[model samples]
Target: MTNPLKTQVLIKIDTITYKGHSVIRINIPPQKEISFVGEKAFIREDSSTVEAKGPKLLAVSQLFQK
Candidate 1:
């Protein structure tokens, strides 16, 4: 069964020289369970991406709350 919280993202960019525009779509599935596996969450800090863990992971998970 599909998750009710599944989400998607739509992006559009206009081109110059009368080439019209470009569009893209992204599909984001809801996290069913917390499994690190080969996946590591990162957050942007200044000009770099820092690994997220501990409290940081909790904070990120809270963003998806209904």
Candidate 2:
């Protein structure tokens, strides 16, 4: 069996890790209004999670690129 999301979980002797390597596609109609809460709209850039707003939101939507 395999995960449709192409996600992987590994359990070490003392630690657990999860990894995902896949492209996720979402369809949002043009001019659609979308709202995201503070907790939900975060962009992971390098080692930090940044609040997604203005240009940052566009940056975050790129998906799996950050």
Q: Find the candidate with the highest lDDT and give its number.
A: 1
Note the residue pairs that clash in candidate 1. none
- Note each model's CA RMSD in angstroms: 7.0, 12.3
* CA lDDT scores, all candidates in order: 0.54, 0.45
- Estimated TM-score per prediction? 0.40, 0.32
Give, for candidate 1, the lowest lDDT window spanning 10 residues.
1-10
Model 1 segments beyond 4 Å from truth? Answer: 1-37
User: Tens digit of lDDT per residue, candidate 1, span 1-66?
Assistant: 222332222222233443565544345444644434357766557999688799988887777564
In TM-score terms, candidate 1 sits at 0.40
**TM-score, model 2 to reference:** 0.32
Q: Compute the lDDT of residue 54 as modeled in candidate 2.
A: 75
Lowest-lDDT window of 10 residues in candidate 2? Answer: 4-13
Residue 39 in model 1: lDDT: 71
